[model samples]
Target: MSGLSTTWFGVIRSTIDGNVALSDINLGDPDGNEIVHDTIGKNLICTNMFPAPQIGDADDGIPDPSYPFSTVGRNVIGQCGFVLAP
Candidate 1:
């Protein structure tokens, strides 16, 4: 399927799990580049998925001053206003 539009303005299920799936998401197709997502028209597309975990706690006397995140270097937001040039 070289020219098949299996991902044309539609949501695709990229992954799944048994009994532990975290709500299957619909992340449309990739634009010119088959890696970046296209959310230009999808009004429900959110920019930030989760806020960077803070290191301080309100009850703690001293702040931890350190943020330990497992997925800090990954881009989660879908690309908006992206157009495939013809």
Candidate 2:
């Protein structure tokens, strides 16, 4: 994912259900690609798959206070975004 327009977002409002394994999503992959603007929403349980963000938790896969989010710390959106401890 390279040469994206300024108006486009890298990721937004995505959901991950049971049994799906994900990690390091768009973590400077494809040689030299870094998702600068992304808002991802996930519905996952427990451990194993985690978005290992290197540009700080708030700036990477995790949510932060930006154009998409109104405030800081709150990354996940929607009711399903909340994960219950299993």
Candidate 3:
């Protein structure tokens, strides 16, 4: 028989709003100084999604052990989700 295989998935959601500005000015005769300014105004929101695992009873011939199946499910839910931003 082949060895057991496993996979994991996950996702994250966030939204960001901000502003950026750049400016340069020169004043003098022939030689002048350059000035630059950057400013940002933002609002951000972040969320994490996780789900519970499903398991069957041992008498039902389902794998009740918490090594591979359960672990995989937990990992998947813990790491899988979606993000919404505008």
Candidate 4:
């Protein structure tokens, strides 16, 4: 199976108007995409976007449990960013 490691930076806060605003999230690589978990009645409750897992299998290039990490569909925290690996 093919796997991918991605790096994404973004903020996280309540969707309410004028709420306690969280800012400045600099997540490193192996960080997966954002995951929206709505336990509460509302939507966009929490921003669960962690980095991708360390590449390589248990020994070889086998993907770990956290495979197919994507940087798509992340809510606007405040600002977001990403840098291309040279």
lDDT (C-alpha, whole model) for all candidates:
0.23, 0.28, 0.19, 0.27
**Model 1 lDDT per residue over 1-86, tens place:** 11222323222212212111111223233231121212223132223212211111321334222421112122333332121211
TM-score of each: 0.14, 0.21, 0.13, 0.21
Cand. 2 Cα-lDDT: 0.28
- Per residue, candidate 4 scores C-alpha lDDT tens digits across 6-77 of 355322211333322222323554543332211112212222333422222221344333332223233333
Clashing pairs in 4: 30-51, 30-52, 31-51, 31-52, 32-50, 32-51, 32-52, 57-62
**lDDT, candidate 4, residue 84?**
8
Which candidate should be chosen as best, given lDDT against the real structure? 2
Clashes of each: 0, 0, 5, 8
TM-score of 1: 0.14
- Give a tens-digit lDDT track for model 3, residues 2-32: 1212232111111112521111222222212
TM-score for candidate 2: 0.21
Better of 1 and 2 by TM-score: 2
lDDT of 2 by residue, 1-86 (tens): 22232321222333323232223333233222122233333322112212321232334455554524311133332222322211
Error of 1 at 6 (Å): 35
Clash pairs for candidate 2: none
Cα deviation of 41 in candidate 3 (Å)? 40
